[model samples]
Target: MTPALLESFPPFNPEVRLQPPAIERWRRGTGTDVEFVHVLDSGRPGPTAMVVALTHGNELCGAIALDTLLRQDVKPLRGRLVLVFANVEAFGRFNAVEPFSSRCVDEDMNRVWDDAVLRGARHSAELRRARELAPFVDAADVLLDLHSMQEAGAPALTICGMTDKSVPLARALGQPETLLVDTGHAAGLRLIDRGGFADPGSDRQAVLVECGSHWEPASAEMALDVTLRFLRHLAMVDADWADAQLRVPAPERQRLVRVGEGVTAVTPEFRFLVPTHHLKVVPKAGTPLAEDGGRLWLTPHDECVLIMPSRRAGMAGQTMVRLGRYES
Candidate 1:
């Protein structure tokens, strides 16, 4: 269904700075049944770590990082290192002029991970692709799904879903100054929140890294840095080599941001009080943050911090922005 809202209140057109990396070279399967999925088996027993990129086609930074890693022939030293280029059909449609339109072919791939959606009769370009990738995703011991924000100048952060297992892992990564602990979206379950990754009793772990703005050079750099750190953390790659590749210095300490609520757009007329609201904090409770048609959306608590405020057309049921607070 077409979204009820078809326009950004004040149209947002950010400059596209980074070129999408040429990924046609990695299309062929590398001894794996899945196309664009390469596995580096160390032949030694250890964890199966999977790193996925291009969850959103417009978010090219992760693809750049994965392409660079594949070009360098980085092999695992422990168990298997699974490198995935997801949503390639949508990625193939990426046009520099209209980048965001290609986020998915039919629907957002990130939201189709629920078991019923994966197993049911729902048909979409993303769902079919998700089904193909589900087996590998389920087998992973540690999963790192790379993504980027729509808004520029937003801080790099990690989405550690509502799991105790992931928060410590995100903290240990030591980059990306902020960490978000929240439940999976009401729209659908994200890949990180699927299967054993979200199970407290299971030892499996997953974290989604929002490197930075979609086309920024820094976002690509951050993606590669986090990729190296993730592999190093699992001992899948050499610590010294990974350290040498790291360009960004780790923050002295990371802040935990627990999301209290996600304001989902219910009407076509959803518009923020200001043009941009990423990381903006409302000092008082009940301050009007946005308006959805005739309904007003207010801050539920004092010092409500907005995270990843979307500039896209407010589709009904889409999360406009998440309200959160920083932990000391």
Candidate 2:
């Protein structure tokens, strides 16, 4: 399906960067060591925060932002700060010029969650690596898994679970396009959403930060700003950080929807409308939407976030569309 949707997914073949001195490479479920960034401040013990990027190799925006942050010489406040370069091998295969492939390698990294697979024989290396990052998520006050999504979309968006603790945090850290993707399915489980066996202790918070489409400058910049704002939101950094980037002013919390179980299939030759990442919505009578493919396919009837179809089209369900309203 994916192969037919777009021409082909591309991979970037850049030379790998050596590990930094402060960062450590540790082995977990994955036998080989992957680099993890851990900064501790026992001087004044406080809450711990873990920021992870590149769960999906193709989602490179977050990786750039985190790598940039790590390079910045900054001191931690009261609590400790940990940064992880979650998936390096998959990221290495990234090709900003192409789509689909950027998000993953052999299998989607985000969809590698399950008790059976976790307990499955030594399967794909990515599956093992995911288990390795579990401890980092468990030890934090907040977990921000940064990622760059497909489609030339709006401001930063978040994928959160159904919980008051999660809701308020998501709302508080609102991005202008505060799209509440119900994910009719839960986070991480969907090949698109990527579920994790992560823990949710009491009110611990986790967010899948979709920075922007791959390679776009705006996507990269937004990703960098949001990571810093997150530090302030968690008090990991101080006013200094906020004062630096206008601090993504209180975002206008917009429409929220459930990423329900509706399937949108596309033909092999489906191409995105160029110039802008715009996908036209074709709706049917007595039906919320319809497209001319013989008969209109029925859609979920409700105020839902249309997973905006990308002008850059792919196979069906490759992308979804939505018209978000201003949340007063």
Candidate 3:
């Protein structure tokens, strides 16, 4: 099946210029080799912000961002910067699935960042890189995991803002227009938890940002600006970093259709295949969403918000599914 996402940026030559630094290397699993680009700044060493990309093979926005980030001349004020262009093999796989090939080569890379799997020999290349990057995480303070989605929605802020400290950062991030999802966990642990650290004893602030739909050319540029803004926000970048403000466009807001339920046919363009029917409703539960097996199927009784209604992608399920929303 074709993946409803895409991205494109120039190649990044780490050695061509002075990058943060290569702190370490992890084993790249079968048919894959991985390397992490680690950079350290002692100018005013304070907090550490680790930026990672390409956890998913097909998610290209982050990859493009990494290319641009690697090439940029960023001098930090305090703390350090860890820039990683991860999952080389999965990322290198030619993704031409649908809109592009579903870039998921082995399995979803983001879903398998478990320690038990990492210690074993059965894990994939991504898992190993996640484990390798774990240590650098402990040495620093912040982590920004970049990603994209399958549908057309506002460039969202999916911060794993669960802790007291991280919550403030996430809240700051989810400002004028943003949705905060408290994974009911800490900020920097599990890859999803934002607490995913290499060193267990270190303090870390982490958040995952879904820039926009896959294949957005502008998404890469947006990521660069946001990273710069984030650095300034953290006091890592120069106080007067050039144009470090990044905001969502008002028109982009209209694309965020507060995804209702039911099996609304998903067109490749990331829009509803047909006009929305009376099948689903937002902020409401137990409502009939769509027809399955020729009968009215209802939504689960919960405060759920949907995103990226896909008819295909995962195995055996309904034609479409709902994404859990961030409770304000």
In order of appearance, the predictions have TM-scores of 0.95, 0.70, 0.67
Give the distance in Å from residue 158's predicted Cα in candidate 3 to where it truly belongs.
Answer: 2.0
Q: Looking at model 2, which ten-residue stretch has the lowest summed lDDT? A: 14-23
Ranking by TM-score: 1, 2, 3
Ranking by lDDT: 1, 2, 3
**What local lDDT does model 2 show for residue 274?**
19
Question: What tens-digit string does per-residue lDDT give for candidate 2 at 1-328?
Answer: 3443232223323222222222222212122243555554536777777677777766666766766776674456768777777766676665534534645555556655554555578577677677776555556777777776555444566766533345556666656355444432222352222233133446566667677655566666677777777777767678676558643455544445445543344543433221122222224223333332333444444332345444433454443344322233
Off by over 4 Å in 3: 1-36, 96-102, 161-165, 174-176, 182-190, 194-203, 242-283, 290-297, 300-304, 313-328
Off by over 4 Å in 2: 1-34, 97-100, 153-155, 184-201, 246-254, 264-285, 288-296, 302-304, 308-328
Model 2 TM-score, 2 decimals = 0.70
Give the alpha carbon lDDT tens digit for every residue of 181-255 in model 1. Answer: 986688999999998999999999999999988898899999999999999998889999999999988899998
Between candidates 1 and 3, name the one with more favorable lDDT. 1
